[model samples]
Target: MVYITEELVRRRAEHNECEIFSLEEVSLHQQDIEKIEHIDRWCRDLRILYLQNNLIPRIENLGRLKKLEYLNLALNNIEVIENLEGCESLQKLDLTVNFVGCLSSVESLQHNIHLRELFLVGNPCTEFEGYREYVVTSLPHLKCLDGTEITRSERIRAFQGLVEVKRRVWEQEKEYLRRRAKEKEEAHRKTTGEQERKGSKPGFDGRWYTDINNTVYVQCPGLEENKENQEAAENTKLKMTVPDLEEEQRREEEFWHTPCPFTPESRLEAHRHLEEKRKAKEKEEMKPKTPRTLITAEGRVMNVNEPKLEFSLTEDEENNAIVLDLAVYRHLDTSLIDVDVQPTYVRVQIKGKIFQIVLPAEVQPDSSSAQRSQTTGHLVLTMPRVEGEIKVTKGASRPARVCETGRSSSSEGQNRKGHVPERLEVDPSLHTAPDYANIVPRQRAKEGPLERARTPPAASSSSLSDGFEDDLDVPPLI
Candidate 1:
């Protein structure tokens, strides 16, 4: 089948009932794609679109197609399953032979009531032996899966098998009921005859029955029943059963059978270490602590409760780059006042939900030593900046800022600021982030906030789609 162009798609749109299109076997590389910005635009009325063996990379192109019902994206380099946010009509999706490895990426597709079939055959995600079963259990509507179809014959066979099983169960239940009723009748007749012979009320044979049927009996000496007392009547019998003792012993043995993986020497060492640690922890709890909170990389509370802000700058020998390491204090509070940044004077601003750390040009370096001299060569480096600080929220619940400033650059191309005027000055052996890495060009001040308020606001439904522009500059812990 031929891949549609803008002209071809325009011609097809005029034709009514043209609901399906196939663009198979086309070597549609990223560079070859000139005008298909979002392929869904051309196939807005499409019910099925076969884009098999095409060189599609991302799923952002399919996010706008609200009418998509069936899609075949097999043999693509797709790694993520996204952009199908509101395609409610999508019933079947063929993602076989793709690079996808995670099924949780499309777990939200379970919300689609018509999503009955999903083909993920050649993908490693579906190849996991337990994954298919897990998906089936989680998504109840997933009937036909993994390039397989549920036909009418197959459904009928399953129904018939279930009916046969149910019939056998009912027969067994009926037979059990009949046997129990027959035994009850025989026992009633024997007891009535014995009572007539004695001409008195029913007497126990010095035995107690645990179950109502009296199939199993136990003998307990000094056990007497008082007809007049209701509580004694209920309490006269022993509550022990055969299964109870066995289950109790099984639990006890299981509790004690848990093995500890430690040698005798290791055990002694562990005991000593544990005792020392316990004393240290108690002393830490009793000591006067700092007023700082530590925020982890994932924005959670620090396990240890003592407060201490530690900072370090490490140099990487391989990449010739420096890394900023800041520790967050364990104490989290709402009244957290200042974040201490050593060897630098930076103004910290907390405006609403956003926190900004401004680094002046005086304290920061212009460029690393390697980039000022050579065009294409290797170089080694020493370390600098032994401390830094990162602003964290009260409970370390969120990272207010991130600082990934120190990095090395290898640029063989010209700089962006016009021509190289005069000096051939370049440092080929220094390590630093790209020259423009931390630089944000100063912008002119606009009108007051009240004056700009008259304009329409940005759509709340729209997300910040650009990845690099996301607030990733702040470090959560110091």
Candidate 2:
């Protein structure tokens, strides 16, 4: 039921910069499209068209692709080789793994003199006796048949016996047609019997139900008198079925029909139909399945693979930051994604779909950063652990690295000059509060005038965790 809408065409043609008029190529494979439409009008300058692995029942609406050079219609429901006579520039045509039984349909390509290659492998017509000879004789210009080069000798032999080949091909075509007629009749009867069992009677419910919503009749002459009686109508005494169920029955009948495949992509097409029915049945059952909650009632973030994108999470002990590498689609735009970092977890919303995961350990949200790879489009998150945060001097009077006990900050954060700092472990029992106000100096006459007379703002105990050093000119408060 999926149609080739303007929005769909534009989205698929994003590589063409969303320009369909002058588009040269397009891939609309595996879209489950029941019919081919619009492309012939939308992309007139197209040279290559790939419509493979779909439910397309026929090859039409493509006669206008006069500039087309190669057309791929493999793995579809196409049963014939007609309607391609207008492709004046066609050089290659692929119709592999289809149900084309009428081998003589290959005669249509006689008009496409530019065609150099034609693929009819895995088709019912390929099984016919002297199928190669018939095609070779019909189209003397063909260079290859079913991937094999059509040698000059084969063409000469086919032309010499062209009279007998035509006679034999015609007899086989008639036999195939007779078998097809029986199949059509059987499919029609099976469908009719199923419909009879599904038919229902409309019972009294509303005046709208009895009249089938023909409100215009209510305004007509004699109908005005019946309106009063219709208002008091009841369904209690009638054999009334829910209107929704009746409507569903009508839809089901229209959904499952067999017209005898002119393009009998037999086994593969049946699989597609079964898959569609299973999905439809699941929707009708209305099963109540709750989505996985990213966060629990106890305020604990949970690990989840809801979107199931390929990803890898690892901890960098040397830098004390958890690095996450997510393999998002390289073509997906960064604008469609939103990232959120927390102490317990990281959440990413990619085009409205949420991908969340819990951290192995607590992290500092304020210090965390996220960036996307230019080449791979993989999202990389660097979350510095809270324990990895280090306190620095409250004043910029004397330049220095972090305290001997703390780790050095990155060059961008605070012009780091020293080597990578080693972790220092301290026993909690021996640790005590330090005199932050006296940590600097009470007198500094020997060191000349201070960088600023702006008395290093009184350091408060609460300033212990404030480590942001974006501005070097403004001294930090401890």
Candidate 3:
């Protein structure tokens, strides 16, 4: 029980500058001191303290010395680094040849961010692999570790090595948790089985038992005799009910044949009546035809006119896109055309006519573009295809479009009074041409006469009546 005392402090301070005993540094090495008590009361201004080679098992109670900058506890029995949180100005710490076994023992020093040098040689943690690297990496501001200055390359290697070490430690922790959970589940099952056994009623065979007073008792001795009596009574009851059961069965047959309410025929007739009524109601619902309408995002109703809009989807392998060609008989203001493209569908609205095409394959919406050809008056939309299959939703219900006459000029050679002219099938080969001619005006001038001849005729021309057809086969576009 060696304790630090006031007499000892005064005696130790005898060699100081003054007899008044105000010293900045104190050396109490090899003093056989096992406990440090009340040292701060006399040496409150201590800047350095050396208690090396003592029996102090823990570092504590030095927090009041706010200006403590250097502390050496080397060659002591200290096992943990703690209670120095108030030493805010501490910059150097030496704990060499101690019992510290893990890096966590020094973690309390992390709060002292200004610490620059650390010495922990001959400690149990020094035997670990990458011990110097671990300490240097953990305290990045530390310039010297174990009296050796840290290098740039060592810091880099420490950072890289810590990644693998942390991953391995994390995997080990996860497996430990899994094993603990399995152990808990097994323990719970055993507990439940024990409880079930305790709650169940005990079974009884023909057996004897002895009471506390040593009196003997027999259980279920007449079980076989009781079973024989029960069987004999059941046979007597069956003999008396035979004639009555046959009479009752005959009456039930007679009731089934009787017609009015309880007979099977009447139930069959009622079921047939309900089925006929259902069929008649379904037939009545199918008598009237209703026009299908679609509502736009702007809350406007548009009538679905069959055969009014015609479009085709052609795969342009040269352009790596799927081209959609729509015939527009009415002149459209190019600026008012609204096109919305999604992965699964494309919606195009020009004036009053709206066309929504659901694509069979997914497409990159950001790469899709719509252009109206000035030469043929056709709207061509190019969408670059993606990898996966696209899911298309059914079209929404649209409001009815109000009938307006002469709001816009019709295309040339189109009938003005009668039903709208049917759309003529255009040559699919026209889509395979290079898009530069339509997208860029400078490229159109470079087209030779042979290329110009291959261009499709304008929408106003009667090209379908020429009776000239190409041998190229075009698949139907949905």
- Candidate whose lDDT is highest: 2
| Candidate 3 stretches greater than 4 Å from native | 17-21, 166-478
User: How does each model score on lDDT?
Assistant: 0.48, 0.78, 0.67
Candidate 2: lDDT of 234?
A: 31
TM-score, model 2 to reference: 0.52
Q: Considering TM-score, which of the candidate structures 1 and 2 is the better prediction for this target?
A: 2
Candidate 3 local lDDT, 1-478, one digit each (tens):
3588777676677767433236677778877677776867678887888899876778887987777899999877676688988888899999988766545556678788889899998776676556676676677878888888999998888898887654554454455446545655664564456335434322386222222222233334344358766655544432122225577568557645655422122333344345656886799798986534555679554434343677788887676688989886546667767787877777776674567766767789999888888876788889998855453669986643322343323332244657666444456666675677556443555765544555533344463456655532433222
Q: Cα deviation in Å at residue 57, candidate 2? A: 2.5
Worst 10 residues of 1 by lDDT: 347-356
- Tens-place lDDT per residue, model 2, 294-361, is 88899878776666799999999789889999988899999998999988889998887789988888
- How many clashes show up per model? 21, 0, 7
Candidate 2 achieves a global lDDT of 0.78
Best by TM-score: 2
Per-residue error at 137 for model 3, in Å?
Answer: 1.7
The list of candidate 2 runs beyond 4 A from truth reads 195-272, 281-478
